[model samples]
Target: MTKDLLGRHRAVLPDWLALYYDEPLEITHGEGRHVWDADGNRYLDFFGGILTTMTAHALPEVTKAVSEQAGRIIHSSTLYLNRPMVELAERIAQLSGIPDARVFFTTSGTEANDTALLLATTYRRSNTILAMRNSYHGRSFSAVGITGNRGWSPTSLSPLQTLYVHGGVRTRGPYASLSDDEFIAACVEDLTDLLGHTRPPAALIAEPVQGVGGFTAPPDGLYAAFREVLHERGILWIADEVQTGWGRTGDHFWGWQAHGRSGPPDLLTFAKGIGNGMSIGGVVARAEIMNCLDANSISTFGGTQITMAAGLANLTYLLEHDLQGNARRVGGLLIERLRAVAAQVPAVREVRGRGLMIGIEVVRPGTDEADPQAASAVLEAAREGGLLIGKGGGHNTSALRIAPPLSLTVAEAEEGAAILERALRSIS
Candidate 1:
């Protein structure tokens, strides 16, 4: 049955839509932190479907809200006043920290980011954008244009004149050897030099933690320093929080808070975890920027009744249960455990990230060269050992990404870490 489904998927799906594992397993059902494949094999789900499932699988609150909303109405276009959408927007706007904020919903992170690009360009009257090196925003043409990861970006053609900036990846870069203060200074100086050479950009869009770029991040306050420069030039700072939002990073509610000294970003884009499993994406900005467009526009399916219900319920559950606190505690322990394991595996290059968004970079035993083969082997081994994880990096996809539901428990974290330890050993 799995083979037949795989055959059909390959026939119909785009080749670029990659799947994990050499022999891909079909996820049949899930509960809490575990999911079962079609063959009745249960695995601890650490990736949480690329961190889209912020809460546990089949979370009752989200499930009940989705069911109830579906019974009444599944979708109503943006033409009407949507109560759920309005309520969710109200909650998000209050939490967003932007003064006089306005929210615009979309169906995916790509759309949210594209909307952000549109707003920034229109408001500033500039087509130039500054994007961080090794960042991945989304897959749309507009989002792709700003993406700096060569592995994920397939085209050079772009509607925006994007200038790639320094300092997104701290471990592997020209300034990697510098002290934290020096690194920040160097990156800011580089940004200043880059700006001197080019026209003033509409905005500088960055991921607080570069997600597809292997969960890499600069030292805290790097953005705050850059914000000082961008602010002087009246350039907007747009935080792409698609993967790093909703307390996944543990310490902060929004990833941008890591650079809180600079105050809130001019614009922020978020998706993935906000709706648990439902599609909910949006941009939050000061009213002036969000209202820049003069013409009418609306997403056909954005903020549909069903998705808004899910977002409201999921956000409520996340806050009520303090999942962010849980992520901090459990994820801290999990990282320590993995760091211990990684210490014994020479192929493990680095263990980095905050909270649940941890990454284990794989490299040749004694060299800095990326070891994608070892990463793939470890992934296959982990699957065999009843654990499911993800792999990603800008350097040929050699980093093991471990972002579980924010509600992950200590026991489950320990179990997954043990399985991952054995998998890393197998690869070594």
Candidate 2:
């Protein structure tokens, strides 16, 4: 953990890696809810490696599994059957509660979404997809095509068909005045309008709780209604649980459960938290939908031995310790604290989200909308105070995203909140 080591590492990062507005930090090591920079400065991990690292960074169980599996076999092509991969897929299907579920593993969340889109659209042989505004599927061609935000555009290729609808979440301004009834009505109306006079879509992609686009939670019953609409249209519903799954939401093991249904989505994509820090992603498909997929469509790096082992270890840790329950309790506490903070702080507009996927929207004078600069300042101040957070919303910025690892403790949550309060105080 020295400047020399960072210099060597930085040299390896190619210029082709787009500078996404900000520079990357030189982090060296991490354990549980804390990380160390190259200069050996400890920082609280409120961002959880940009919403990954489900069991906390450097968890012994995940590391041991990866190490042991790597020693045995790092990878084998999809041409061969690997025990760890098969077991992991079985576990995902069982936990997902999807009947006759099938899985397609990949290396990242984007890939999982991409696979979901391919399987879903191909199954129905329908090109049209209905997506919500402020939705983020991923950066890949298919994913970006359905993404609602314009900032991520510069589309490499156009989707065969796509339509955008405004869901329960709003990206334009604050929600202090919106009522529950109004929220549901807005979503329903938009969905109706999108479906009206349009060809029945192949699939409807949505996040049970929007993450990267903004920490916007959908209204109650919205999912139920949305699902009904898709069902009527003969379209599949794909839940992008990449940021919301693996017990991060607390109420259930997966994000789609928040919608309160015996059966959730026709297809569900998962990544980020499954393998702790390892590169792994997957999709759980309904039996009927999966049955339509061709057998030859397999991924090369999907479900590699190391990734599968890590996923298994991570899942074991989460279930054995009931980390989802911790997320519900701790995340509820954090949201309440944030609401209190928002009341006192003028720049703080609204606090929203479920479990650990939380956001603190910064308000400006005479404006209920997002203030990206203020959010950035708060992120910097928090980092200076030994906490790390992320910034995201419609305009490539706005609210501070406070998704931490499930291992984050109550004491750490309190300390991080205090630091965030101080950061807001420093902003004005």
Candidate 3:
């Protein structure tokens, strides 16, 4: 029977397609913060579908909206406007405070980033761009061009533009010695140097808080300084809120606001939390830059009626229930617990992040090098202990990332922390 199902599924998929996941666990269903695999084993989900499922799996309102939209009309080509699309854009703008900000919808976080980069490149009419070291943008030519990781390079290189690398902020260890002010100053200086070195560049793009880069938040004053420097150089600043946006961070509806900066970027990209999993991303731009476009950029699948409904409902649920507040309360508990765990365990290096976007760096005992194996052991042990977690950069496999659903409770967070503690102790 399993073989029959496999054969049937195989018929629907392309032979050239690849499976990118590891240690595959077949999932059945999820409710709130708990997911059960095919074997009926429940796992506490600390990894919220790569930080996309903000309100939790199969949220009532979000699913209901999607269902209603699907029953009505799932798609209306860009030649026409749909109500859900209109309402979603309006609500998002209202929440984001980007007055009259026009939106261009896409299919994924990477696609939104790619679109933002395109807009900046066209607006600035420049060939060079700057990105933070160790940042993960997207795999497209332009995105890969600006992404700072050399590991992304392969047989094919991007033809769109040249990339200039800048220093990402560091707040701990060798980077710890520098005060927040010092670190921000260094980033500003490095960006300024890069701007001069690559003059007339199109834009400087970065995550408000480095997401896959170990949930690292940039130093204070960094975004303001970048905006000032980039604007002075006639360059646009693009905020990639792929992982950090949509209330994953507490207090602010968008991660960009969590930076506590005043100036807004030329363009902003969001995807993960927007659709609640229905494949939607919104690109909101400063009105001036938005009006600069000559024609509408439409997609075959972007912002379909169903997608808009799901996203609008997801954002609504996040607001009505004040999930951001929950992210604050619950994420605070998780961070504090991890800090306590780190203090107790020698292998645990640091716990960093705000709200639900948390990372715990597990250090090797001998060389002080990042111990990815130890991190893997911890993740596996957490699974055995009935919790699910993810990892991030700092040594691809070394940094343990814990960004659970914003709806996760304080008690659940405590359980996750306890599981992490047990896992770390066993490894040590």
- Per-residue lDDT tens digits for candidate 1, residues 1-428, read 99899999999999999999889999989999999999999999999999998998999999999999999999879998899999999999999999999999999999999999999999999999999988998999999988999988999899999999998988787998999999999999999999999989999999999999999999999999999999999999999999999999999999999998989999999999998888999999999999999999987899999999999999999999999999899999999999999999999989999989999999999988999899999999999999999988994547999999999999999999999999999977
Which candidate number maximizes lDDT?
1
Can you rank all candidates by lDDT, best first? 1, 2, 3
- Against the true structure, candidate 2 reaches a TM-score of 0.93
Instruction: Provide the TM-score for each candidate, comma-separated.
Output: 0.99, 0.93, 0.92
Error of 2 at 249 (Å): 1.4
- Across 1-428, the per-residue lDDT of candidate 2 in tens digits comes to 35565467569986545422143467889998999987688999988877888878899999889889889989886889889999999999998878889887899999999988888888999888888777888878888888877766558466657887766365453442567667666677768886887887888888888887668876666787778767877889888999999888877777777675536789999999888889999889987787686766667899999999999999999999989999999999998988888788888777888888898888784577668888888888888898898877874447789999997789989999999989988987
lDDT, model 3, position 392: 75
The runs of at least 3 residues in candidate 1 whose Cα sits more than 4 Å from the true structure, single-residue gaps closed, are 395-397
Q: How do all the candidates rank in terms of TM-score, highest first?
A: 1, 2, 3
Off by over 4 Å in 2: 1-24, 168-178, 395-397
lDDT against the true structure, per candidate, is: 0.94, 0.82, 0.77
Compute the lDDT of residue 133 as modeled in candidate 3.
71
lDDT of 3 by residue, 55-125 (tens): 89989998899888888898986769777878888877666656568888888888888888778877887
TM-score of 3: 0.92
Alpha-carbon runs more than 4 Å astray in model 3: 1-23, 151-156, 165-167, 172-176, 395-397
lDDT of model 2, residue 392: 76
- Lowest lDDT sum, 10 consecutive residues, model 2, at 15-24
How far off is residue 117 in model 2, in Å?
0.7
